[model samples]
Target: MIRTTATLLLLALPLAFTRPAAAQETPIAYTVAFPNAVHHEARIQVTFAQLPAGPLQVRMSRSSPGRYALHEFAKNVYDVQATDSKGNALSVNKPDPYGWDVTGHDGTVVFTYTLFGDRTDGTYAGIDKRHAHLNMPATLAFARGLEQRPAEVKFELPAGWQVASQLRPDATKGTWYAPNMQYLMDSPTSLGPQQTRSWQEQDRTIEMQVLHDGTEAELDSYVGLTKKVVKEAAAVFGELPEYDFGRYTFIANYLPQTSGDGMEHRNSTSLTSSRPLRGPAALDNLGTVSHEFFHSWNVERIRPQDLEPFDFERANMSSNLWFAEGFTQYYGELLLRRAGVYTDAEYCTEALSGIVDAMLTMPGPKRYSPVYMSQQAPFVDAAAAIDPNNRSNTYLSYYYIGAGNALALDLQLRQNYKTDLDTYMRAVWQQHGKTQRNYAPAQPYTLRDLQRVLGEVAKDTAFAGQFFRQHIMGHELHKYDALLAPAGLLVRPARPGQSTLAARLQYNPDSTATLGTTLLGSPLYVAGLDREDVLLKVEGQKPISAKEMQKRLAAHKPGDVVPIEYRTRNGVRTAQVTLQQDNTLEVVPMPNATRKQLAFRKAWLAGKAK
Candidate 1:
């Protein structure tokens, strides 16, 4: 049986009972009220009934789903209290920072707390007079042992407000349903006076609910653009996943108070941005829309085994995010081009070239493979730390590394294997992602599974093995120039003759330059200069700004060793640093191309919305 919300509720009822079976069948219910919303607070109550004859451990999740970092969500909860079925106060023990242990409950426990939230984004909860945006883990507390119990939530919304969420709507007004803890935690809710637009595609409802400070007409135009993006993304996968609720939703919050972020969930996506629905900002916002919707097929369902049962207690790391997130990152922009939202030049210069440049120029990918980089997501993926990190030298985002791999593999597949990435993705979908078992993938994939699928798609195990070893596991980049030639694209240096120190500098008011992390093998690093070192002079001349520094470097040619003076924590230092030619690369169309090249380029970039 497919665990739809209704079916799961029915199945869950039989497991709980102490009073009459009818009364005992009551699911775990929560009631949320926002009387103190002006103060960015919400009063939340959760009732666990038909207990198993022991103390119930009620706790707040330390981590949210899709977010790899531990957010310590319990810190925001205060004024915690618990009561029994007769409303008598129970003993609540603060055994740890994350949770409370409640004893002396009369077969039922009602746990309540005041949650304070102010940030509006995908990972945390935001509450105000304007709206209450709730990412479940950041808002709700759950009983430890009752993970399998069905759950229902009721929102006591203020007047003139409505609720929008992926949770199943119940017959009772203001209530929504989830099958189990996994589904409940994955569901994010927005309660506000928001504008909504919905359409049907292949008999499945696709809805866009936006909480924005814009007119209805502007939203209508944005929705039109969004529809095109939706069409292009669906074309890549051939069809949308069969949504668990027979619907898919895009819950967007674009307001002055919102922070920019995109989070993917089963059957929906949370898109929050401070940009409005107008002009270039609108297009930029749609970029996130394209990315997050594509994730509906990739990360949300095309699951990685390491993240299969997402642990809410600690950080979740994976070795397959390159394919999961990186491939999606590649398609996010490609689909925009396919939808005609971006011209060929715009895509090549802005999106495609950026990926190539980071992979080729950045030292991180040269040192760490995509698999190793993917494992670092817990620390780098929005993780907070007071200590400085050497990420510039040791790390490149898996998003970029994976996208680079996707680009190389796509070009190689087209040239040698007589196929494309779309075909391989569909094959992976058929093998690993298409089957749904409750709230997650029935068959989540591993690194080995991905390699196997690639072998199947290419019809050659040897090529797949070599590609995975060189790119995915081993730190080796592809010959991009050769791979892009068939499509009449050239990977060439952006500034070939320009000389550089290759270190980012923050010009100070005191006529000194503070160096950021100097890249490995750069002139600054070779001269024993690192981050926070103040550059007193270069070539015996003080350069006050970045432009001035560039002008000074322009006077000399590459390989010219010039005297430099800098100050470090110990004392002043003097060294001779050799200037290096700029190695930044870009992807551009060849001026003169054969008809075959044009055709190949068109075949690759043209819309495939049928």
Candidate 2:
């Protein structure tokens, strides 16, 4: 998945099943109907045939691929019933919150349930009069001990609705096929009145299927931009992955009812957004398209060993998301720049600046390594909770940390090794990603394998080992200013002389201000101020608004001490805090760039497509 959450776009081609069903086993069959779609409900049934046991265990998925969190998909299921092959009522037992155990099945059990979903994003299902957006794990129930069996699904669609999915199309109309449970769960489906465009790339079909409220002209313009993005993304890898079925699809929903998300699958991506593709937002939406398409190589194939064989029963965690997700983050924007969707200045100020600033200013990266940050995804990647967490102070997203690392590494490789990130990516691709085994990578990489590959790419094992030890496994950052100098870019403070308390203040109508999460080393934290503390005065003057607070702080310089009064849970108190300079940074072009610098920058940013 490209975002924290998690598409079905498909192109049909002549291809053999990646995993063929055994002679003795029967395919698990599923039927889905949106009879109550107007009420956001789906009727789903699964038939497990040739069951050998006295009891059959059936369950909903607790986790999704690409998303590291547990989503508890079973909560949306209701009115579950079971029956034997002869249509007799079977005994259904509730063994746990996630599934049911059925007895008296007579070697076959047909399980039925009602699923209600309103959200239209990667992790959940959405059904309406307009369409049915299905993320399989959130829509289907699977039987245990039958995971290796082939799976077939048929959707009973409303009039004029077409199916868009990566799942293999069966000979029967509205039916799709998956060789096994893993592939079935990874495939998302969108059934609606959709507009589709197809093109050939490397003799493989590339498709774009859109469910939108926009005009045909708007869709046409978006497809043009998508073509540029797809071409540039393939340039980074030198070639696209050998997509299963010899095709890849981009399934997008650009409707007001859709939520903003992008999820990558083996051969397709699910893109949902409320933003219309007719204005600047169209380009913004393309950023996600760029990100997810890059994942076809980086994540779907060059996978983390920890995430291979994704567990649908619980949270899936990985220590290499920084590289898996973050490097893709770096390239996502970079590809846009390469495709001319964004100019040099736009890339630097809009994309690079944020990445560099976040790594430098955020306390999380200073306190924890990229590996540690990646491990926190299960808690932060759309995982819901009631209690408050100090993630603002202690946790930085692996996405940002990894992009920062990728930026530094890319520059380091260019400067020190006479190679660049694109070269390194190709190396990783050749070693771990190029070969596919059924639905997964033939050689899923480990942390050590990544380090070894870096060493090989750089042609210096010592430097690679040192680089990993410092920036990846250890909490250390590269000198950005020096590294970016060769390309005529400068990393400098956004506000050079401004003094700040470094705490977000939410001003209340009652003439007081409440603090957001204070940074670990900020002035507020040093003065023992934390989240939910109400500020009454700064330097003995009551600041009524954020502007007033800033006006008061502008009177002082960095290192100046000021008295503040605030109300904590214990009561009101006063403390003296020493202010610090605003450390927010930005990357900008040098004023007098040399010819060599210009050449280097152009070579790095220009499109690599042939």
Clashing pairs in 1: none
How much lDDT does each candidate structure score? Answer: 0.85, 0.87
- Judge candidate 2 at residue 451 and give its lDDT: 95
Whole-model alpha-carbon lDDT for candidate 2: 0.87
Mark the 10 consecutive residues where model 2 has the least summed lDDT. 5-14
The residue-by-residue lDDT of candidate 1 on 168-272, one tens digit each, is: 999755589887888888888888997999999878899999999988999999998888888988888788889989998888899899988888888777888
- Cand. 1 Cα-lDDT: 0.85
Mind giving the per-residue lDDT tens digits that candidate 2 earns over 1-610?
1344232111111124333544348889999999899999999999999889789999999988778888999999999999998899999998999999999888989999999999999889999999988988899999877777778899998999998998889765557988778888989889999899999988889999899988999889899989998999888888988988888989888888998998888898999899999888898789889988988888888888888678788888889999988998888899999999989899997699999889888889888999999999889888999998899988888888999999999989988899999999999999998987766777789999999999999999999999999999998977889988899999999999899999988899988999998999999999899999999988787769888888888888999999999999999999999999999999999989999998989989999988
lDDT, residue 414, model 2: 86
As a whole number from 0 to 100, the lDDT of residue 494 in candidate 1 is 95
- Model 1 quality (TM-score): 0.95
Top-scoring candidate (lDDT):
2
